[model samples]
Target: MKIEGKNVFITGAAQGLGEGISEALLERGARVCIADINTEKGEQTVKRFQEKYGQEKAIFLKVDVTKADEFESVFKDAVSRFGQIDIMMNNAGIMDESRWELMISLNVMTLVRGTNLAIEHMDKLKGGKGGLIVNTASVAGFGPGFWFPVYGGTKHAVIGFTTSWAVRTHDTNIIKLFILYQFQCSKHQTLIEMQYKFCTGI
Candidate 1:
């Protein structure tokens, strides 16, 4: 899809990979809504973007992705601000083994919620323009992670969930779903590699 003039709603965009994605989108002339739990960093990121890309190019909304209400509200607010959302990037995730349940909630459940909202707002059959939903998974989803078993499990769940929706929506052709896998070489790995797959169906 063409990136210019597209409106993107992205989570965990305050820093890291999400921040990079937001910057790339803006550089390509897309308007981005940078949603994150970290208000301070999020504001700073948006400020920087606005200064570089112009004031209307980006906006920041503080959001807790694990909460259904807050997550849904971000979508509503993004649509209100941008007029319509053309891309939804579910990039917020954590790898906390101590708090495994929260990990599952943030990494898996919240992503599901975000994808659903994207479909609801962008499906052409529902009187809205069709768009793309990009879910962030990890290389851990492909195999065992002895040091971070729970984190790996959450990523695995993400892959399964996104692919399932991809198949479900194939016939309609109203929305496109994609899986983005992040890979790190080792514990001391500073560089991150990203791989994406376009889901056609099962």
Candidate 2:
């Protein structure tokens, strides 16, 4: 898509893939909202982006993806700042099995809620311009891993939700759904089975 002049809201923009993606989009002339729970890192990221790009090109909001109100606020604030949102990236996630519920809320529930909010703001039927929604998943969503099964399950739910929405919104050009799967060796068990075993005391 032509990103120039478009506005994007990304969850988990404090670090990792979300941060990288936000940087790339900003570099391509897109305004971005850096939304993440880490206030310091999120502000740092937005400051860096604004300095590197321009003051109007980036903003940061402290958002906890697991909280519906906070997550919804990101969208509202982004629209208020940028006039409209062209893209919504539901990219926040976690890999801690010890806290499986938090992981699920972070990975799956956030994406679901973000998607709903994105559609509400970007739907043509709702008197807004059309937009794109991208959900970040992991390779584990489509395959198996001996370690981090719960994390994998959360990603799987993401894939399912995105696909179901894809089908439901098939004929509509108002919004598009995409599932972005990142493949990193560190996330896969094959590259760290021994380390996993050592860490888990297995």
lDDT of 1 at 31: 95
Q: Which candidate is the best by lDDT?
A: 1
Q: Which residue window of length 10 is worst by lDDT in model 2?
A: 193-202
Instruction: Score candidate 2 by lDDT.
Output: 0.77
Off by over 4 Å in 2: 175-183, 186-202
Clash tally, candidates in order: 0, 0
TM-score of each: 0.89, 0.87
lDDT of 1 by residue, 97-190 (tens): 9999898898889998998999888776778777878888887889999999999988888888887788777644545544454455442221
Where does the lowest 10-residue lDDT sum fall in candidate 1?
193-202
Q: Model 2, 49: alpha-carbon shift in Å? A: 1.0
